[model samples]
Target: MLNRTAKFLTICLLAQPLPPAALTVTAAASENAALRDISKIQVDERRLTEAVASRTLTWLTGSPANNDYISVGRLANFFGFVGLRVTSGHSLKRSEVARETLSVLTEQQRTQMVSLVHAQKDTLNRAHEARQEMNRALEGLLAFEHVTREQFIELGRDYGAREAELGRLLAQTFGDIAQTLSTDQQRALTDIRTTHLSGERRQGNGGGDPKLRQSKADKKELVNLTARFLSWTTGSQEFNDFEVVGKPSQHFGFVALRIGSNHGVKRGLVAKEVLEILTPSQIDRLREAALQNAREFPMFLEVRAQLMRVLETSLSGGVIDPAHTAHLGAEIGEIEASMTWSQAAAMLDVRDGLSEAQSADLLAMRAKYTAETDSSDLDDPIERGRQLFAQCAFCHNSDSRQPIGPPLDDIVGKPIASDPAFKRYSPALVRYARAQSMWTEAQLDAFLKSPKALVPGTFMSFDGYEETDDRSALIAYLKTRK
Candidate 1:
C-alpha cells in the first residue's frame, strides 16, 4: 500500500491528518477500530516464492569469512590440549599449530591423536567437497525460472548427507582430542573455553571469538533482538526455511547467526554472531537500540493493520468508493512518507559518518561478499528462461489463477484454450483449441515466436520472442509447468 518508488527525503513530520471530519469517528477511534478488527483477522502466512528464495539465498553466498576472532591465550590452550605444539612466550602463525605436535604428549598418544586427526581431516574435506558441489547445484537452481521439486530435494539430500557425516566425525574428534591431553592440559583447555565456547559449539565456527561470553540477561535480550529482526524481515518468524541461516542471508542481503547451510539448522544464535564479530561496544549500542526498537516496532505493524482497515471499511462492496479514496489514501500516504524519511536518514547518516578509509573498507568488503556477475548461474539456460518469463508474467499466472490473462499452467499438454473454466481466451484460441488435439513443444515454440502469426485474430498482444533461444527457453519453461 506504500509508494516504494517515491523519495520522501524532505518529508515534514506534521501531525497526520484525520480521516475527513465527515467520518463519525475521530482519528484515534478509527485506528482503535482498525486495531481491533485486525486483531481478530486470521490469515495464512505467506512463504516466499521459490524463485525469490533461491535468488536471495544465492546472494547470501559467495566468499565466506575465513579468519579468527579468538584470543591468543584461548588459541594457545586449544592447540596445546589438542596435542598441537604451542611454544611458550613465542609468537607463531596459527597454521603452525596444525603442523607440529606437543612434546608433552607421549609418542603413543601422538600416534593415536594423529590417526584421529587424519579421520577428522578426511571427513572435513568431504564436507567441504560436498559444500562446493552444493554451491554448484544452487547456482543452477538460481538461474532457472522454474525447477522441478525433484531437483531442489535431490540437491538438499546430497548436502544434508555430507553435513551429517561431518557433524558425527567432528563430535568424535573433540573426544579424541581431549583423550590425548593430560588431565591438567584438558583442565586448562576447559578453563580457556569457559568463556569463549560456553553454550556454543566448538566445531567450524569460522574461528570464533574468546570474548563473547554472555550473561543470562544478555542472552535473553539477544534472543528477543533476533526474534524482532526475523519478524521484520520475514513478515513472520515462521516465514523461514530449514537451510543454514547464514547461507540464505548470503542471498538475502542480511546476516543471520546461523552456523552453516546444513539441513534443520534455521539460524545461528545471535550471541554467537556477536562473538564472531566481537565488537562489544557497538553491540551494546545495538542491543540498547534493539530493546527500545522492539517495544516500538508494534507501531509500524499497526500502520499496516490500519491500512488494511482503511481498505476494508472504505471500499463499497468489492469496489473503491471515490468519496473514501482520498481519506484512505491520506492515512497511508503519511505513514509511507515517515518511513521513507527515516530510511533515507539512516543511509545518509552512515554515508556522512564514514571516513575515507572506512568507506573504502566497506566498499571492498561489499565487493568480496557479492557474487561474481559472470558466475555460471548467469549463463544457465534456466536463468535465461526465468528472465524471459518475467515479461510473460504480466499477462499469465503460472498457477493458472486470477484470470488476468490465460494461464500457462498445463498449456503444454492440454489443448490450447480448452479449459471450460477459462472463458477469457480469445475466440481465435478457442477455435484453435477445438481444432487442435494438444499443444506440442513445437507448437508452443512457434506460438511464442509469433503469436499473431499463429492465430491472426488472437486477442493476445505480446510482441513475440524474436530470438530462437528465447522462444526455446519459453517453451521449455511452459513444458515443465504440467
Candidate 2:
C-alpha cells in the first residue's frame, strides 16, 4: 500500500494544469506524474469498479440505446469490446461516438445483422462452454504447486483443439455479418479493423509489430507505476482465463499488449521505441498525446475492469443482477460526461505528423520483427530446434532460474528429482523417477510429444508438440544445454 502522503503527491503531479502548448509536451515530469496517478487511481478504486460493473449486466441481453454504433450480429464482439474498453481514451466511450455508415443503414439491414448474431447463439454457447472447461483445467494448474505430466500434456492438447473449434465458429459468425454489409460499409469495417482500431501511424506496413524491448530497469519502473492498473490483469484468474491462448506476441503487435494478461505493453518503453524515428517536433506531439491519454485512462480502466468482472462472472457463474448492470451504464454515462475527447484527434495529429517514409519503415520494422521464421534456415535441424523452443520460452528458462517450470539447463542428463536447484518437484514425477532415474532422450520425446498421457499430474502447462519434426527440433535444442 502506498503511503497517504505519497498517493496525494502522485495525484497532484498528474492533475497539475498544463500550459496551453499545442503539440509540445511542455512538462515531461507532469506527463509522467499523470500516468502514474491514472494507473494508481484505476487500481485503488475497487468499490467504484464493482458498483459500475453491477450495472453492465444489460450488456448480456442486448445493445442498449447509445450514440455508439450497434449491430445485433456484432453484439457478442461488442460485448467483448466493452470488456476491453479501457485501452484507449477519448471518443471511444460506450457513448460519445457512432459510425456514420452504421447510422445511415436501414432498419432491415440492421435487423439482418442482429438476426445472424442471434442465429449463432448455439455455436457461441458451445465455444463458451469449451472455454470454461479449459479454464477449469488451467485453474487446476493454478491451484496445485506442480502440474502432473499427464495434466500438462492433456491440457495443452485440449486447449488447442478447443481454441480451433471456437475460432472456426467465430469466423463463420463474423463472415455472415460481413456478407450483410454493403461494399462501402465493408470498406468502413476494414478501415475500423486495420486503421482506427490499429494504433499504428505509419504506412505501407505489411502487418504485425516489431518485438523491440526497452531497458529492463525503465520497464520495471513503469510496472511499479502502473501496478494498480495491472492488478486485475496480472492477478485476476477470471481475466487470465479470457486472454488469448496463443503464444505471447513478439512486439507491441496489432494490439498494445501481447504479454498476456500479465501486463500492458510498457507504453513508455514502446513510446521510446516508436519515437526514435520521429522528428523532435513530432516527438513532442506524441508526448502530449500520451499525457492527455493518461488523464482519462484511470477512469476508463476502472469502469472496464468492473464490467469485465461482471461479464466473466456471468460467463462462468451465470447472469448477474439487473440493478448492477444498470449502475454500470450510469457509470459509463458519468465518465463520458467529463471526458475531453482529445486523444483520438491527438492520435491523428501524431499520425499525420509522421512522414510517409517513416510510416513505411515503422511497418517494415514491425513485419521484420513479427514472429516469422527464416525459411533459409529450415534445412538446419539445430536452427529448426531453436525455432521450436520459442513456445517453451514462455514458462521455462534455459538457465538455472525457474520461471513457471524448472530450468532446462543440463536437463537431458538430469536425474528426475535430483536437480538441487529445483525445490518443488511434483510427487508424481518423483515417484516415476524412482523407477526410471534419468531424463533420457526417449523419456524426453514421449513427454514432449504428449505430456498428459506420460505423466497425468505434472505441472507443465504446455501442450506437447504433435509434429514429430517439431518435437525433435525442440528436443535437439534442449540437448545443447545452456
**Residue range 428-449, candidate 2, lDDT tens digits:** 7888889889999889889898
Clashing pairs in 1: 56-251, 59-250, 59-251, 60-250, 60-251, 61-250, 143-383, 144-382, 257-268, 258-268
Q: Superposing all C-alpha atoms, what RMSD in Å does each candidate have to the true structure?
A: 24.3, 24.4
Q: What's model 2's overall lDDT? A: 0.37
For residue 307, give model 2's deviation from the true position in Å.
43
TM-score of each: 0.28, 0.28
lDDT of 1 by residue, 341-414 (tens): 22222222232333334333433333433222221223556545644554354345423233346667667777
**C-alpha local distance difference test of each model:** 0.35, 0.37
Q: Which segments of model 2 are wrong by more than 4 Å?
A: 1-377, 398-402
Name the best candidate (by lDDT).
Answer: 2
Residue 47 accuracy (lDDT) in model 2 = 24
